[model samples]
Target: MRADAKKNYDRLLAVAREVFNEQGVEASLRDVARRADVGLGTLYRHFPTREALLEVLLRASFDELTAKAKELETADAVDEALVSWLRETIAVAHSHRGVIGSMTAAIEDPDSALHASCLSMRASGERLLNRAQAKGLARNDIDGADLFALVGALAWLNDQPAHTSRIDHLFGVIASSILTNGVPVSV
Candidate 1:
C-alpha cells in the first residue's frame, strides 16, 4: 500500500473502532469514511463490506486475547489461570455492544473473513482449557466454544442496565460449574 493509503487505512480503523463502540456493528459506513476524512470509495476500497471492516478492526484485539491465553497456559494455578483468562475475555467482550455478538457469529460462520482469526483465538483458548481439564482443575464438560458463548452472553447482559449487576454473580456461577468439585456461588 502507498503511504497515503496506509495512513487512511489506519485512520479508518481507528475511527471505525470509536464509531462502533459508540454506535454498534450497524454503524454507517459513510459516517466512518466522513469521520476518517477519506472518500467513501476509499473506505470501500479498504473494507468492501461492514463485516469485513469489523473483522479487520477487531483482529488486533482477538490476537491480544489469544496471546493472553497462551501466557496463562504456564500460570502456577491452572484454575486461577482459567478464571483470569475468562474474566479478561469477558471484559473485552464487554467493551461495547455487538462486539461479542459479531465474534460469536463470525467464529461459527466458515465463510466470514473473521472466521480464521476467530478460530485461532478459540484454538489458543482450547489448548489452555484442555490442559486445565487434564489436570482435573477444570470440568471436562465445557470447551473453548462453550466459553465463547458464555462470554458473549455475559457481554450481552452487561449491555443492559438492569442485568449489569448480574455479571459477577453469573460469572461466579459459571466458574463454579467449570471447576471440578466446585461449589455453586450464591447469586
Candidate 2:
C-alpha cells in the first residue's frame, strides 16, 4: 500500500476502535469514517464491509487471547488456568460492546469473516478446559462449545446496565459451577 493509503487505513482502524468502544460494534461505518476524517469511499476501499473491518480489528485481540491460553497451559493449577482464560475472554468480549453477538454468530457461520479467528480462540480455550477436566478440576459434562457459550453469556451479562455490578459475583458463581473439586481458585 502507498504511504498515504496505509496511513488512512491505520487511522480508520484506530478511530473505529474508539467509536466501537463508545458506541458498540454496531456503530455506523459512516460515523467511523467521519470520526477518522476519512471519506466513506476510503473506508470502504480498505474494509469493504463492516464484517471485514471487524475481522481486522478483532483478529489481533483473538490472537492475543489464544496466546494467553497457551501461556496459561503451564500454570500450576489447571482449574486456575481455565478460569483465568475465561475471565480474560469475558473481559475482551465486554470491552467491545455487542461483540459477543458477532462472536456467537461467527462460530456458527463458517463463511463469516470472523469465523476462523473465533474458532481458533475457542479451540485454545477448549484445550485449557480439557486439561482441567483431565485433572478432575472442571466439570466433565461441559464441552468446549458449552464453555464458549458461557463466555458469551457472561460477556452479555456484563453489557447489561443492571447487571454491571454483579459481573464479578456472577463470574465467581459460574466458575464455581464449572469446577468439580471445589471453588475455583480466584482468578
Candidate 3:
C-alpha cells in the first residue's frame, strides 16, 4: 500500500473499469495490466480474480448510492428522493454494459464478493421506499426486490441499441408505478 504500489493498483482499477465497460466481466486481466502499464503479477497482487475486480468496480458506486439514500431519506420530497435514487441506480448499472447481468446473480449469491455491496444498495433503496410509503407517497406493497427486477429490465433495454433511447421513459414509468397518486395499489 505504498505510493507506487497504490498508484499501480489505482491504475489497474481504472483500466479494468474501462475494459469491463467495453468487454464485460470476462475481459482479460492481461489486457488490463497492459493498459495500466503494470505487470500481470501486479494486477493479481491487487485483485485475485475477475470477480474480485468486478466487485471493486461496483463497490464505489454502491457505497455512494447508499450514502445518497441516507441523505435523501431525510429530504422533504420523499417521492422525488426515491425516484432520483432509483434513476441513479439505473445509471450506475448502465455505466457498465454487462454489469446488470452479473449484479442480479451476485445479489442473490451470499458467497459472492459483491453480495454485501449489493445488499447495502438494496437496503438503501428500501429505506427510501419506506420513507415514501410512510408518507403515503409510494405503494406500500412494493419493495426493493421489485426495483431490482426493474433494474434488470432497464439494463437489458440499455444493452440493446434500439431500446436505449426509451430508458428515461421506462424509468419514469417505474417511478410512477412506485409513487402513488392516493389510489390503493394491490401490488
Best by TM-score: 2
Candidate 3 lDDT score relative to the true structure: 0.84
Q: After superposition, how far is residue 12 of candidate 3 from its true place, in Å?
A: 0.7
Better of 1 and 2 by lDDT: 2
Shift in Å, residue 146, candidate 1: 1.4
Q: Which stretches of candidate 2 lie over 4 Å from their true place?
A: 184-187
Per-candidate alpha-carbon RMSD to the true structure: 2.0, 1.1, 3.4
The digit string of per-residue lDDT tens for model 1 on 116-186 reads 98898878778878888989988888888887787778878887789888888988988788888575634
Give a tens-digit lDDT track for model 2, residues 96-181. 88999999999999989999999999999999999999998989999989999999999999999999998998999999999998
lDDT of 1 at 119: 92
- Which candidate should be chosen as best, given lDDT against the real structure? 2
- Residue 27 error, candidate 2, Å: 0.3
Off by over 4 Å in 3: 182-187
Task: Report the Cα lDDT for residue 144, model 3.
Answer: 85
Listed in order, each prediction's TM-score against the native is: 0.91, 0.97, 0.88
Pairs with steric clashes in candidate 1: none
Please give the CA lDDT of all the candidate structures: 0.83, 0.94, 0.84
